[model samples]
Target: MDFHKLKKELITYSKEIGIDKIGFTTANPFDELKSRLIRQQELGYQSGFEDPDIEKRVTPSLLLEEPHSIISIALAYPSKMNERVESKKGMRRGIFSRASWGLDYHHILRDRLKKLEEFILTRVPDVRLKSMVDTGELSDRAVAERAGIGWSGKNCAIITPEFGSYVYLGEMITSIPLEPDSPIEDQCGSCTKCLEACPTGALVQGGQINAQRCISFLTQTKGLIPDEFREKIGNRVYGCDSCQTACPHNKGKNFHFHGEMEPDPEVAKPLLKPILTLSNREFKNKFGDVSGSWRGKKPIQRNAIIALAHFKDETAVPELIDVLVKEASPVSRGTAAWALGKIGGEPAFAALVKAKVVETDSEVRGEIEKALNYYK
Candidate 1:
């Protein structure tokens, strides 16, 4: 009946339950986003991780019957780790991006959505609702932008004034006719920081990204990283945040509002050499809870090898040699071959020469050859 009063109640309950921000918007089809998605698809810019169906992604009505309005919620995560892990002379560490610093945000955001759903059910007993996080067909950023959660920043992140771009976003589509909130004004006028700071130039101009070239997206792929981007990836074992970290809007905006989001320094910034040797069980036990580990340990290990190369970590040369000779995944072995070359010594060079004789995989052999050249 009184939808306005109900919206007020939902906002109050959301804050009480740790939702950092909440907003409402009509369930009209996202025409603009659909066009952009088409363009991204045409240009081969998509990361291959998004929903393939353009209609399903932009049309909320298809997701839920007669969806009248959408509710968007944001949970702020800490940008800075309160505790620090020391990287000594002989030991180097790789950093997981801020989003993956703590617990997997999917679990945290889902918990908040579940609470909101229960609260809504109490007031509107027959309310029809659908909720989703990053993996959902509906675009979380589009919903958040329409719902006034934040402006779409140049980095392609929803930038909330209070929390900057360091916030996890999710949404619920409902049959309730809640009043829609106005979208925020674009604040990234003439700011090329994100575009300039992108290592692979993934940020195309402004307000758009070529996900294929994005270091964040590349780190998540379960294959050999392109040779051009490998050196640019540096020590990022998970996602890359150069774009967000470069945004002026995110300055001094760290918020440790939720306990689940606190980083375990050792897990978030672990020693590079240890990651090279993690068993599947060991990787799961240590990084299983973080969002970045969703692709399993192969990509992380691959990135760890690259990070060792980035640092030219001589200490990791032995472990990298083992991976080059014995790792099951070709991506891992190939990456290790590259790392060994980057950290060249008599032993590393000898191992590459040895592996060159027996390595059958064309890709692995190619990487070994490349490493040998680099070593010379």
Candidate 2:
């Protein structure tokens, strides 16, 4: 089998199918990644979503029988929207990061990977292959970095010269041996822009990130967002893009190759108060297709409340009061109490005072008391 010829054919096919970048690497175990994950666990830096088995995560052979090579693919999404969302009077909108702007990237990358698998099967009828998007056990970044798709940027993203770090990544492990591509040289070069731009210092140092403090991870958590990061979260409704936007390589790197990847302006930057009013069915109808909605309605709604607090939107006080008094979810109620306190006034203060007396949940009551102190 002419593996080199197959690789070239695959590359051409990838482009034809809308893959922005593609690279090849051996299915060798990722030793460095295993150690990094162990250290991350030790330091309590993990976001709790990582697949816990380190061996399975780094070992491709375990995932696929006789895996000989891995192919990494990237698809660029637009960094800037073609049309901007105009915030109307008395309406404060929360921003979803560029990564979560359009359809959920997992689906997009998976579709590309599936097509690649089918193409390979047409050439080698019985060749074994395993494909994975972000949620797969294998680290998409590690595979992409080694495959020469891009360098692992300080922001912990794969930064391609062509598409910058604003690309979704996926990989396929195959039994067919293929020639490897040269790894990209690190070009970050003492640049600390991403580190400096991290709102919660989630980027502990360059490539290392404390996911617990990361606004992206925090926004996806079902529990109450920690006090330290809530104010830092600003108006983000889902995910965080500070590090990516701050990276020098990403400047002038917007790409809108795929229509499915284009974001609806209103959905990407939806009004804060409206978010608080979404029922489970309504939330799913509005946001289910987006990757940020994987964790479902609670986390996004909680983040919306925080965003309202960040804006100090007095207009949100009534809705927030409804959340504080009528909401069943303690996290939402507590966060609403805090938001009301943040947007302080007679109504807000009165609401908090009322909530403080009647709030059943200890956590919610504590939030109310703390919010009342803000009035002092």
Candidate 3:
């Protein structure tokens, strides 16, 4: 079925469905990715999702029975005014990264791809289609690069000239043999802004990211954040975009993908007080639809406590004292003690001392003692 014409029709249909960019290519073998993941595993970069058989599981070729073509697409979700993104003095900006500012990309991108597939089926009835939105075994950046969508930048993100690194990537794996776009050449010369701007040194040489050290992954990972990395996480209560913010390629960019894709102002640097009081139901109602809510309120609450602690805002003392008094979660108690220690003063000391007496968890007790030491 004329592959070139099919690809063109697919791109046209995809745009109508609201996707910003679309390109077709062969499935990447991800040989380089597998080797890099192995090395990262050795270095303890993937501690949270460290599966011995990760290479076997996440490989692109292993996902589909007889995958012949890949259709990669991009969606732009840019931040609104620059004021929302600007760094504040005592309080950090609470903006979601550019990609996550709207409805979850997984659902949005999948819906668009489904429509594209339906259009293809009308043209070729027997076409077999499979798609993924970051859940694929495929190396998304690799597939994106191979499709001429964008080059993988030093921050380990796809960088398109039009959308910069702010575009979300999704793909379709099909049995049909569509003509493929050639891979784009790397545009990052000697610039190391992304690597240099990484607070925890997660980005090493040659676009490698240490997931264990990545603030974005750590905040979402279902485990106690390692103490060494916690301080470096700073005020990023959710995902981080420090490297992307530092990239010259991402600065002063215009997004023309979807007219409705504006960043939500309420989420852009929200007050520290309200976020601290989110009930589980309320948290779910607000964030459950987004991709960041996969871990539910536990991690986000933990991160909020951490960010408040890192900010050392004395204003949070009253709310923290309330949490210390009534909150039952051991993790909450432990983080509260840590925050108290960071906030350090008469009020925080008194709360820590009171919490220490009633706290049963050994870890929480330990944090309480550490906090009380500041008073001494």
Candidate 4:
């Protein structure tokens, strides 16, 4: 079988199927990535979301039997929202990062992968294949970097020269011996913008990130955000894009290549106060389609409370008081207590004093006490 001719045909078909970019790499074990994973694990820099087994993460062969090569695909997303929602005076909105602006990318990428898998199977009748998006064991960034889809940028994003870092990445492992594409050279020369722009100093150095300190990761946590990072989180309700936004390479690189990636002005940048009161069903109806909702409503609600505090939105004080008094999630209740203190007024202070009397949870009580001290 002419594998080279087949690779050309697959590339052509990929373009026809709306895949923005595609590349191939030999499925050798990722040695460098294993070392980085070990170091990240040792230093406790990893977000708890990563696959725990380092061996499984770095070994593609372990994931798919006799994998000969891996195909990486990228779909560019718009960096700038084409339409804007005006936040009137006394009203503030929280921003989900560019990645979460549209429909959940996992579903979109998976659909593209399934199509590619079918296309390959039609050509090579007995082809073995496995595909994965972000949740998979293999590192999507590592695969994209090796497959020449893009270079691993200083912000830990795969930065394609054409699409910049604002691209969704996914991969498929296949048994075919397709010729590997050349990896891009490091293009972040002498640029410390991403490092300097990181609010939590999560970008420890070029191409390395301490995810534990990342605001993007922090916004996804389902517990009370650490006090030190809460103020730094700003109005980000989902992921943080400070590093990506700061990259010079990404300048003027917005692309709206796919219709599904377009952001709904109200959904992508929803009002902060409204988010505080969303019922479970309301939250699902509004944000379930976005990738940011993967951790569910608790994290988004918690972050919305923090964003209100960041804005010191006096109008939201009443709603925050209600959350402190009635919210079931201790994280939400505790964060509301903190937000009330941050936006202190006679009413907000009174509510805190009242919540302090009945709040039984030790952590929530501690937060309430800390908030009360803010008035003093």
Candidate 5:
């Protein structure tokens, strides 16, 4: 089989398999990205992605051992279903963004990439290949841009004109040399909608993101959240899409997807009332296939309580009391106390006062005191 013909065939196959777009490029190590990663480390912007073993693979030089061809694929995940949830009037209405509304992209992208990889191997038996979704060392947006599938917006997301930034990226690193796609020019020009819309100012000037200040990272982080970000976290419990939501490029369009990228109905309008009731076992069963499950129940549960607090729904006070008294995890207990304070009234206030006497953990006690201050 001709290598060029094989590449074109691969593109067709990728589209048929429900990928939004596909393109090819040569493996060129990103020196600038490596330097950026180093800087991010120095400034503590890389808390979530701190595995040295994985960091080595993130560089193009380390990712492509022999350096031949690159195949990048984009899967668009839209908010047609979740847009209704965002349109709701009450504080129960908050955005889960779009990309994370269904099954985890890692699984969806990997299953497709594995099939694509197998097809290529059958065509060229001697060719070598490795696949990486967001988990690998290489940057998905950078590789996607290099392949000409899309341009990186000022928010640092790969933005397709048709689909905007609501896309999941995956790559196949291969030994077979193929034709390369031309890089697109930056289209952002003078746009700062993403930066301006950030609730926590995580987007610094020049398209840089300070991950520590990022609500998405903070919500998923274990242990205590820094006091600075606590109030700004608002109702978000998992990943944030404020920058993407604020981007003019993404507004007023109904970008769609096929197959695994499709949104799950259950997640579209996630019930806050039921979210507070999930056991760890139930959480795994409910969200196991979704991207939000990667951190397990602790983060989501904590965020649920915070979202309840944001709503200031006294109705949730009973549930918060149940969590504060019965939940074993410190995260659940601490956030429950915080929510009780935020929903302060006779019932909630009285419950907090009761939980405070029995709460042994210093962190939970501290939160109880904070809630107590609101009551007094």
Candidate 6:
């Protein structure tokens, strides 16, 4: 079998199936990435969401027995929405990052991978292959960078010359020894825009991120956000895009090739207040298809409270007071307590004082005390 011919055919088929870009590389262990990850761990920068096993992350053989090559694919997502939702005073809305603008990318990329697998199976009947996306143990960015899909950008994303970093990445390991593509040169030369633009300074330096300080990671946590980051979080209810949006390469790189990749403006920038009252079924019905909803409504709700405070929406005060008095989740109630403090008025101040007396949960009461302290 001519593996080179097969690689070319695979690239063509990938483009036909909405894969914006594809590249191939030898599946040797990611030696350089292993060291960087070790340093990342030692510096306490990991988000605790990734797999803890270092070997499985860097070694392709562990994921796929006798893996000889890796095929990396990228699907570009649109950076700007064609339709805009009003985020003005009376109709404030929370913004999800560009990555979460459309349908969940995991499913989209998985579909493309499954198609690629079937195509390969028909050519080499006994080929061994394993595919993975963002949630997989194997690092998708490392595979993409080595596979020549893009250079690993200073913001810790795969920066394709064609798509910038606004691309969803996935990979497949195979037993076939396909000739590899050359990696693109890093073009971030002396650009400090991303690091300077990070609201929480999550971008520690070029090509390194402290995920603990990242608004994207913090918004996904199912707890009260630290007081310091609350104001900095602004109106982002899902992931943060400060680093990517600030990059000069991404300035004019918006693309909407796939139909499902187009964002529904209403869903992408939903009204902040409606998010607070979404029941599990309602939340699922509304945001269930978006990738950001994987953590469920709790974090989104908590972040919504923070967004309300960021807007100082006095109109949301009545509902926020209800959350403090009647909501079951201590995280939501606690976050609401803090929002009341941030958006202070007679009603908000009174609610915080009343909740301080009756809120039995230690954490919730602590938040209540902190909120009341603002009045002092």
Clashes (backbone N, CA, C under 3 Å), per candidate, total: 0, 0, 1, 0, 1, 0
Cα lDDT of model 3 by residue, 265-290, tens digit: 55644555567689888887877666
lDDT of candidates 1 onward, in order: 0.94, 0.92, 0.76, 0.93, 0.78, 0.93
Model 2 lDDT tens row, 267-343: 89998889998999999999988888899899999999999899888888999999998999999999999998899
- The sequence of per-residue lDDT tens digits that candidate 1 reaches over residues 1-376 is 9999999999999999999999999999999999999999999999999989999999998999999999999999999989988876569999999999889999999999999999999999999999999999999999999999999998899999999999999999999999999999999889889999999988887888999999999999999999999999998999999999999999999999999999999999999899888889999999999999999989999999999899988888889989988889999999999888888899999999999999999999999999999855
List the candidates' TM-scores in order.
Answer: 0.99, 0.99, 0.92, 0.99, 0.92, 0.99
Worst 10-residue lDDT window for candidate 3 reads: 79-88
Error of 1 at 260 (Å): 0.3
Name the candidate, 2 or 3, with the larger TM-score value. Answer: 2
Highest lDDT: which candidate? 1
For model 6, how does the per-residue alpha-carbon lDDT over 1-376 read when each residue is reduced to its tens digit? 8887998899899988888899999999999999999999999999999999999999999999899999999999999999987888867899999999888999999999999999999999999999999999889999999889889888998999999999999999999999999988898999999999999999999999999999999999997888889999999999999999999999999998988889999889999999999999999999999999999999999999999999999999999999999999999999999889989999999999889888899999999988888888
Between candidates 1 and 6, the lDDT winner: 1
Candidate 1: clashing residue pairs, number: 0
**Which portions of model 3 miss their true places by more than 4 Å?**
47-61, 81-93
Q: How far out, in Å, is residue 83 in model 4?
A: 1.0
Off-target runs (Cα >4 Å) in candidate 6 are none
Measured with C-alpha atoms, the lDDT of residue 2 in candidate 4 is: 97
The alpha-carbon deviation from the true structure for residue 356 of candidate 2, after best TM-score superposition, in angstroms, is: 1.6
Tens digits of per-residue lDDT for model 5 on 283-327? 878778778778777777777778777788767778888998998
Task: Please give the lDDT score at residue 245 for candidate 5.
Answer: 83
Ten residues in a row with the worst lDDT in model 4? 82-91
Clashing pairs in 5: 58-137
